[model samples]
Target: MGRNTRKRRTPLATKIVAGAAALAVGGGGLVWANFYASAHEDHGGHNRTRSAGAQVATIDCPDVGQKIRDVPDRARGEVDGELASMDSQITDAYQRLATTRRAQAGDARFVENSILGPLKERRKALIDRIQLEINRAGGKADDNLDELAGCQGRPADQQQDGDGQDGGGGQDDGQNGGGQDDGQNGDGQNQDDNGNGVAGPVADDFIDINDVQPNSRNSRNGLAADGDGGSTGTFSTDCGVNENNLFNSDNLIAAPGVDNGAHHTHDYVGNQDNDAFSSDEDLANADTSCQNQGDKSTYYWPVLRLQDGTQEFDANDQGGGAEGNIGKILKPAQAELKFVGSQQGDVVAMPKFLRIITGDAKSFTNGDANANTSWSCSGFEDRQVTDKYPLCPEGSQVLRTTNFQSCWDGQNIDSANHRDHMAFVQEDGSCPEGFQAVPQLQVRLAYDIPTPTVENGQVRNPYAVDSFPEQLHKPITDHNDFINVMDENLMNEVVDCINRGEDCQ
Candidate 1:
């Protein structure tokens, strides 16, 4: 202070500012050194940065043009490849189906040799193979095309940018990518929104069987009757004949003089007084003789004939009594015969004869050449005709064999009967063996049961004679039109996906 030499006093404010500026410069220099060190890091850190650098670098590539100009061409190429593969599979399947159809037809030679036994197995294998191929191709083509169409350009770091917006040494940002945006102008590609390739004018070459409805009437089994009251029960001739008094009793073989086999003695009294009594006496004596022989008082029998013209006895008929002799009872000339019986424990014994024919009397021969060529009979008759006399009642007319012909009424003869009988007259005039007049019940079963055929190792309707209009309309050149429609629909959907730049999977 005494030297006054402390020339000028420095200001406190200026001194403080100078110190702050110095500190700021030092801190800035440290930060710059740290950044430089990181940029030039060693291999260990270098690798990590390199990974990120790759992504960033790729983003610089020009954004894939919004035109997506390559999609249609690529998709079409893929579609063509898939179509070729599908064609091969389809061809194989068609061949198999054809082979199966041929086998099922069973030419006369194949039937004789049983050569078609393996046809079904072959068909199945081929179908499975073709189906697998179709599925594989369908999935691959669908997914691949979709993936290609949806492919987006990499980010800025991954792709080189053609523009020079950033500094010459600018770092890349990994955000830019290419793909269809949500905007309406989307990728300049046309695609069916519903994902059905059928949106455009349908190709004439393409076939879809699904458009046609199947024919329900193709079933091989015949139609069933509409009413519950229709035929029921099996037709059979198992009953045995009666053996007691033949003339008047219900026995198959009644004696000549006793009324033992008599069943309707009371019914005959008013019509013929003396005749009734005489018949009753004859039946009684026959009954006595049968008992002596250890035979039942009454027995029954059925008449069975074979195609070979052989006949067998089933059950015996009950004999008539006092009212009129059983032998004297009349039956309609043109009636079908039905034998009613009672079950003796488990065995049914023949009882009475019922006639089915109505209207006028009809004559039928037992195929006996020596028998009467013609005979008169009532419209309906129930009495048995002796082997020697082929005739109906005095007032009836005769029906020649020519009058009977085959006709079906679509009604089952019987509902309860499961047994079936097929009667056919051979051109040789010989009848089949073991054939008997079928009861109403058995006829229905034969007409209704479905006939089976082997197809692709499985039993199917081989004898199916019915077809629908749609089936007939199908082109013989291609079977795709005949496959289930749903499968075709799915294939169309996949195709649509390929048309549009969308992910099919």
Candidate 2:
């Protein structure tokens, strides 16, 4: 009954059915048209674009997987090279350490402590650097593998020991290299010329002569002798002249004389009584004791040659001709000890006759040869004089045998027992009141003191004599004594001698 009533169909319902049918046909036609078009076209261009896009996307994937695969090989090669270098450096450091130990053993107080600390540090650093490089490489490799395996999201196994823990074992190798750079030798010890481990400023065996500083008092411009008040003269000798004839002999005042008539001498007789001599008559009679005295009284009579090449006969300048004496009273020439030791004496004695000639310092001419006679008995009061002109007496004589000694054996003085007798003289102190101590430079320039021919050939400084081993056997000079007193430690005393002063044995 309901169907019969609805049979009279509604316009809306009919229209809905027609629309649905039309839509189905249109949809089917669109699908058919699409299928047909796809089937007909070759689609080669489209296929290329799609294929290229897919290839690019695949290529963009992370390279971590490949890098992980290579890490083990790279790490092994690098570690091998590093370990080889480390081995050499370690060997060097070990050797240096042994040397340092030996030196310290021989000398108890040797201090070379600065080396050990730096060496240890360097060794540690080298090991650390290697380990760090290894660990970094390993970590990169691990990270790449983990990412590729999709294991990156998982927490790392921190508990694993072999992964990187042992890799840093040689971290101190760098420290060893650094220590070597700081002068620690292969054995990690310092080297010195003395063969001692006590590292100090290096000593030089040879010093440049040009670099040597000149002694202040011995410089060229220092301590010049004054000769303006004296007269320049020459003298001649007469045969068989007695003391009276000797004193009264014309032009004899400045004539060179001899000690016991064997060795030539020079005397410094003053022109005025108060000046140096009492008077011309006194000068003429100065040899009264020897006038007519036997040959035993005669001293060596040497001729005096003046700068002008003139000669004198009597004290009054009475002799005439080229051989005649001049009126000037010849002053004593400054004497200097050119050589000090037996070896030096041998060297000097071979060339010269060892005669003491008197001449004016200013004129460079032979002075009164008789001056040696005056020096014979004179004693030197000043220690400086005794040290230098030990041949002189106090007052009466100009020279005495007691004042002179062979320089080779002259340095000995029992200071431990003879403290009062042996004393150092000051630089300003007098040698003798009349005589002066010549500076070393003056001795070299005037007397031509031999200099060291080779590097470190000899110790030429008078002060250096104190340091000489040979001098230990000789009498100590006043200068040496003074130096000993000032610096007692400089005395290398080896024997049980009284240290009245610093004694070097």
In candidate 2, residue 427 scores what lDDT? 40
Give the top-scoring candidate (lDDT).
2
RMSD of each: 46.7, 50.2
lDDT of the structure predicted as candidate 2: 0.20
Off by over 4 Å in 2: 1-100, 103-191, 194-206, 213-413, 417-420, 423-505
How would you encode candidate 1's per-residue C-alpha lDDT over 1-505 as one tens digit per residue? 0100011132112222222232232211011111000111232334433222111101011111111122232232333233223222322332232223233232323311331223333333433443344345442212222222121112222212332211111121111112111112311111110111001100111111222123311211112111233222211221122111121221112111222221222111111111112333332333222212222122111110111111101001111111111111221122221211111111111111111111010001001111111111224222212111112234444221111111112232211111121222223222245432221111100011122222222222111100110111001100000000112333333334322322332
Candidate lDDT scores, in order, read 0.19, 0.20
Positional deviation of residue 153's Cα in model 1 after best superposition, in angstroms: 99
**Over the stretch 294-347, how does candidate 2's per-residue lDDT look in tens digits?**
101112222221212111232111111111122222222322211111111011
Worst 10 residues of 2 by lDDT: 29-38
